[model samples]
Target: MRAIGKRLWMATLAAVLALAAAGCGSPASNGAGQGDANSGEPIVIKFSHVTTPDSPKGQAAEKFKELAEQKTNGRVKVEVFPSGQLYGDKEELEALQAGNVQMIAPSVTKLVGLNPAFQIVDMPFLFNSREAVLKFWDGELGQKLMKSLEPHGILGLAMWENGFKQFTNSKRPLKRPEDFKGLKFRTQAGKVLEAQFKALGAGAATIPFNETYVALQQGTVDGQENTFNNIDTQRYAEVQKYLTVSNHGRLDYVVLVNKSFWEGLPEDIRKALEEALKEATEFERQLAYELDQKSFENLKKAGMEVYELTEEDKEAFRKALEPVYAEFADVIGKEFIDGARALK
Candidate 1:
């Protein structure tokens, strides 16, 4: 009788313990048992990009990281990997898609393969000033472009500026359209840029960003175009001689997050991130111009011959490339081009 009573008690205790264990595994538990809202393990966000920590894009990434952690009250942590520490320009997107990283800010031109509409900003002389660029990007058209990325498992947070592009060459001063004749220029891997340079009677070659400086030095290519900050930071002026302030096109970056990761974020954390993005965008945009000017000053000291175009001179170059609009109309859409042109 004693032995039977003891066995019955042991069985009852086992059943109660099993029920308690099951309770801990309930849906109320954070997915994967990571944590819950009131008390759980902190979330980790890994942001990766391909620029130095001092560049506008890099600075903006750091700013977002700082703000995100602060606003989330330490519940969220953002780890930033700049200068391709995590992945190069070509691999960053793939990493994000695989969920290996949570976020990226790639050059807008890099998105051309995903959606041709992304190259709208790359249209030569498309934006005449910083204000106009901001107006278009912060308005309906920009939002529409960003939304186009959602179906691709990516979410765009904001449009960050890399300032305007200027031309540099070792052959001779490129002050006029005719000056580009027969000169080989390295260009971003975008059809629009290729069309723009070819229209000027110049030869265009697509080279990886990492290989450009050596290419320029060895005469593998005659020249390249990029923002002043890029030229200064990368020390391109050391290899190239003349700098022409073309402002021909803008180099813009789109902040992106893994769509699933973004959507799965706690609602409050997501809102905080969005708010942090807005603040970082403003800081990056303003800092871009300031840094560009400072870079030009530094380049001048480096003995680069800088040239600015007169209104008449600019109009001539603009007229020469007018055919580009018709050539790319099918890819960029005539109506979309018109809409961007019409922005205030």
Candidate 2:
């Protein structure tokens, strides 16, 4: 636990330093240059995300790349960087803020530090199903939340789906609220998740997503939670033995672009990019649903003991964390929670 804490702290510190350095460069050095949309010179957009090239976000990114370039008659070129090649989850946002990268699709919870409202999506068991999630992102609440990012130098283009989070551990099958007691779980760097684990009498630590597989394999943490796609694509099933379909949380990303870069784009090119993003986002959401179902089956085939709880069992877990709603209400707003609950 101490070692994991030390590593996490060091990683956080390094990210802060990188962000500080990012701001040192002039606006011209930040990649805010807007090549003429109608000119022969290609407009280059560097898209960075932290996931496998074959993952939903990766595929959608490629889709956007293909469509954007094709739609513009090769006037726009999107260079895709996947699996943290350009920057890890923590660094990518700072990179985006500094215009080091023109775009990124990081987890929505990753923005909690910028605006606590971003943590609204991380509220445990917030959405009953993917349908509800889609509605939330496409409705007024979604637009309101996206609008919140303007102050932070990011343009929230859309909410891209990952999937529901399921609990996994190597120690034992986690079927009840008590099952989480004393367990150490890896969570994203956010307060809501920390509180969620604490509510269950478990210890939670924030670790970089890319480091979670090894952390679980080496017993740095007893368990972790993630979408089926993340667990399967990252091969976490090999290290963890138990899979509890808690459906306790959702993992989604905010497709973002540097405000400066996006604003500088010619109107026609911006319109084209927005159109491409709309299609790509829908494709990603549909594929996310399919991949999520498929990943669960794949995990079982890979020798995982997967378990799903009854409604009563789910209720027990939900009841245990009920306090989290009020605890975060001030930050996320009671109205937003009420609105979301109305959807369910």
- Candidate models: Cα lDDT each: 0.86, 0.88
Per-residue CA lDDT of candidate 2, range 1-344, in tens? 99999999999999999998878742332264545554556788999998888888999999999989878777788999999999997799999999888999998888888878888878987777778888888899988888888998888999899889999999999989998999999998778889999999999988887799899988999999998988998999999999998777888988999998888877888889999999999999999989999999999999999889888998898899998987998989987777776785
Compared with the true structure, model 1 gives a TM-score of 0.89
Off-target runs (Cα >4 Å) in candidate 2 are 1-34
TM for every model, in the order presented, reads: 0.89, 0.85
Give the residue spans of candidate 1 off by over 4 A: 1-38
RMSD of 2: 15.3
**What's the CA error at residue 98 for candidate 1, in Å?**
2.5
What tens-digit string does per-residue lDDT give for candidate 1 at 1-344? 99999999999999999999988875453222234455556777888998889888889889988998899888877889998998998899988887888889998888888889888877887776778888878888888888888888998889998888999999899888999999999988888889998999999999988899999999999999999988998899889999999887888899998898788877998899899989999899888889988998999999999899877888898799898988888887776677777765
